[model samples]
Target: MDGVTVIDHPLVQHKLTIMRKKETSTAGFRRLLREISMLLCYEVTRDLELTMETIETPLVEMQAPIVEGKKLVFASILRAGNGLLEGMLELVPSARVSHIGVYRDHETLQPVEYYFKAPEDIAERLIIIVDPMLATGNSSIAAVDKLKERGAHNIRFLCLLAAPEGIKNFQSVHPDVKIYTASIDSHLNELGYIVPGLGDAGDRMYGTK
Candidate 1:
C-alpha cells in the first residue's frame, strides 16, 4: 500500500462510472478512457523531477522549473493499454512510447507474451506502464519482467482499476515499482476477472463483443 496511489478525484470517478455502465456506447467508452487516463496521468507524474532554467517571457526574463531529463516513456501493456496511452500522450506530448503484449491462456491461467518493443535507452528515462485493469496481475508482472530485462529500473504501473489480490501479487513481485490506480475493487471472480469490474477491457474498448 505504501507505493500504491489511488486517485479519487471527482472527474476520474465520474468518468469511471460512465465506463462501468453496461449500456455505455463505444464512442463514449473510448472518449472516457482517454479523459480518465489524462486525469490519472496528472497524479502519476506529480513528483517528476524539475530543473530550473531562465526563460524569456513576453515582457521579461524569469527563472522557471520544468520537468527534467529525457521525457518519460509511456509503455502500454498491449491492446487495452493503448487506450490509456492516448490520453497520457496528450498530457506529456514529448514522452517516448513502448508496447508489450500478453494474452492469458484460459486453461492454464498463464500469461503468454506475444510482443514487446521499447526504447533502446529505457534505463535512462522514467517509464510508466499503462493498463486499464489489474485483475490477477500475471500479464503486468510479466510485462515488467521484460522491461527489467531491457534495463528499465525506474518504473511505475498505472491502471484504471485493480483487485486487492492483483495489487498484492504485483507488489510481491516488484516491490520497488510504484502503482497508481483510479479504483481498487473487492476481489477477482472465479474466471480471474475483477469483481464488478468494467468487464474485459480489450473487448469493451474495441467493441469486439
Candidate 2:
C-alpha cells in the first residue's frame, strides 16, 4: 500500500519477537516499547527536509544540515501511546507533544473521545500519532478525524503492532495518512484483540494486570 510502511529492520524485528512472547515481563515490555519506538521514529522521519547552513566547527566554517520548516508534532493516542512517546521525543526533542484521548465503547464497539488537545499550529506541522497496538483501529481513526477537524493536514500514524483488519480499515478511511508499524499480525480475535498480539499495551506498560 502506498501509505503503509512495515518496519522490518533487524532491531525492530528482534524487539518485536521479545514483545510477542507470553513470558515477557512488564518492565521488559515497557522498555522494549521505548526502544522500538525510537527505531520507528528513525524510519518515520527519514524523509524530513533538511537545509544546509554555514556554521563554524572550531577550525573552519562549514556547511551543516539542519531540519527545515516547522518542527514535528508528536500527537499521542493515550494512554498506551504515552509509552511510545518517550522514545520518539528523545529522538526529536524539539518536537511538540499533543494528547488525543479516546476509549472504545464495550457495548457499541465505537470510539469515544474523552479529551483531545493539540498544538495551535497543527496545520503547518507534520503530526505523528503514536499508539502501540492497532487491533480494531477505532481509536486511531477517531484520533485522526479529530486532528483533521482541528486543521491538521499533514499527519502520519505509527504503531508497534497491527492487525490486517485494522490496517485495511484505517487505509480505507484515511488513504492519505501514512502508517508505520513494526509488525503486522493476522487478525483481530473474537474479543477484538489482535491475535498473537502483545496483550493490552497500557496494562502491560503500567503493570495494571
Best by lDDT: 1
Question: Model 1 off-target regions past 4 Å?
Answer: none
Each candidate's TM vs. the true structure?
0.98, 0.97
Query: How much lDDT does each candidate structure score?
Result: 0.93, 0.91
Q: For model 2, how does the per-residue alpha-carbon lDDT over 1-209 read when each residue is reduced to its tens digit?
A: 56779999999999999988888999999899899999999999999999999999989999999999999999999899999999999989999999999987866768999998888999999999999988888889999999999999999999988899899888888888999998888888888889888888998899998
Residue 18 displacement (Å), model 2: 0.8
Q: For each predicted model, how many residue pairs clash, with residues at least 3 apart or on different chains? A: 0, 0
The whole-model C-alpha lDDT of candidate 1 against the native structure comes to 0.93
Q: Give lDDT tens digits, candidate 1, residues 1-209.
A: 68789999999999999999999988889999999999999999999999999999999999999998998999998899999999999998999999998888877767999999999999999999999999888999999999999999999999999999999999999999999999999999889999899999888989998
C-alpha lDDT of residue 147 in model 2: 95
On TM-score, the leading prediction is: 1
